[model samples]
Structures are given as structure tokens and as C-alpha cells.
Target: MPAEKKAYPLRISPAVLEAMQRWADDDLRSVNAQIEYVLREALRKSGRLKPGQAAPVADDQDDST
Candidate 1:
């Protein structure tokens, strides 16, 4: 069975939002998905998302958790 989905609000600057939208389109993902992807990658690269850390269950998983 698939995991449950959760929604959370995020606030960002207009410029950042626009950049995310463009990146999402380029990657064939939605704006929300793109943001989560980027954040996950960032965390992983920074060592914050270690192997033991819970993996993102899906593309739309809430990364802020």
C-alpha cells in the first residue's frame, strides 16, 4: 500500500517561486514537486538526509518534515 499524503503551506519570495516554476517545467514536474525535489537533493548533499533518514516516499512527499 502507498503512504498517506500530507499538505503544508510554504512561503517564498516571488522571484524564488518563479525560478521554481521554470525549473519544474524544465524537469517535467509540477511546481510543488520541483520544490520538494530540490529541497531533498539539497538536504541529501548536505548530509542532512543520511541513509538512515526516512526516504521520501514519493515525489510529492512533504520534505519539510
Candidate 2:
């Protein structure tokens, strides 16, 4: 069974929201899912989460070039 997800209100700047929207569109994910993916990657990279608890490291793919 999947873990239960909790809902939390997020306050974000319009610019950031717009950027995330664009990225989410490119990745074919909802804005919420994109945000969660980025957050998980950050946590994994920072050693805040165990390797098994988070996704594998994705290849470096910079879209803002």
C-alpha cells in the first residue's frame, strides 16, 4: 500500500509558480507532482532521506540553457 499523503497549503510567488508550471508541462506531470519530485530530489541529494526512501538520482538534465 502507498503511504498516505498529507495536504498542506503552499504560498508561492507568481514567478516561481509560472516556472514550475512550465517545467511540469514539459515533464508531463501536474504542478503538485513536479513540486513533489523536485523536493524529493533535493532531500535525497542533501542526505536528509535514506536512499531507499527516496527516488534514484536522475541524470543531470538542465532545461534552462
Candidate 3:
């Protein structure tokens, strides 16, 4: 079973938060989920995450943009 979520209070500037909100909306995810997604990607890119430790991020082969 997956571990339960632990709540952590975050303090972010209004401008940054608003930007994240807009990006979250565009990605069809809630602001909180978008934040998690962004952080996870960063960790993966920096090689901090172990291979196979987390499920993979899907690639879109059909993306034309």
C-alpha cells in the first residue's frame, strides 16, 4: 500500500503562487498536485531519485508542439 500524505505548511510569494495556479490550471491539475509534479521532476533531473524508486513520467511520442 502507498504511504499516507503528510501535510507541510509552505510559504510562497503571491506572484509565484499565482503563476503556479495558472500553470496548474493549464495542466488540468490542482495547484497542490502541480507543485508536487514540478518538484518530482526536478528531483529526477538532478539524479537524486533512485532508478525504479518511483514510477516513470510518461513521454508523449505524438506531441507535435
Candidate 4:
């Protein structure tokens, strides 16, 4: 089963939104999903999310990006 998701309003600059949209397109994910993916990765890297906790989707690209 999938985890439940909540809806929240977000206010972002147009430039940031445009960048996210492009990145999301490159990743073949919806803009919302891409944002969530990025957030999850950041949280995990910063140790806010414990090991074996909710894992973000795997990113196949090299880290050079």
C-alpha cells in the first residue's frame, strides 16, 4: 500500500517554478512528484529521515548534476 498524501499550498517564485518544471520534465515526473522527490532526498541526506525510513524514489543520474 502507498502512503497517504496531504495537499498544501506552496508559493514559489516564477523562476524557481520554471526550473522545477524543466527538471521534472527531464525526470519524467509530475512537478509535484519531483518536488517531493527532491525534498525526500534532502531530508535523508541531512539525517532528518532515519535509515530504513521512507525512502525516496531511486535517482539513476550521476551525481555531477
lDDT of 1 by residue, 3-63 (tens): 6656778889999899888887898777877776787788899998887465553655434
Mind giving the per-residue lDDT tens digits that candidate 3 earns over 1-65? 44345467889999999999899789867677777779888888899976666653332321211
| Model 2, runs deviating above 4 Å | 54-65
How far is each candidate from the true structure, as Cα RMSD in Å? Answer: 4.4, 7.7, 8.2, 7.1
lDDT of candidate model 2 versus the reference: 0.72
Given candidate 1, what's the lDDT at residue 54?
51
TM-score of each: 0.72, 0.78, 0.74, 0.78
lDDT of 2 at 31: 77
Question: How do the residues 1-65 of candidate 2 rate in per-residue lDDT, one tens digit apiece?
Answer: 34456567889999999999999889877777788789998887898977788553232432331
TM-score of 2: 0.78
Worst 10 residues of 2 by lDDT: 56-65
lDDT head-to-head 2 vs 3, winner: 2
Which pairs of residues collide in model 1? none
- Give stretches of model 3 more than 4 Å off: 55-65
TM-score: model 3 vs. ground truth: 0.74
Best by lDDT: 4
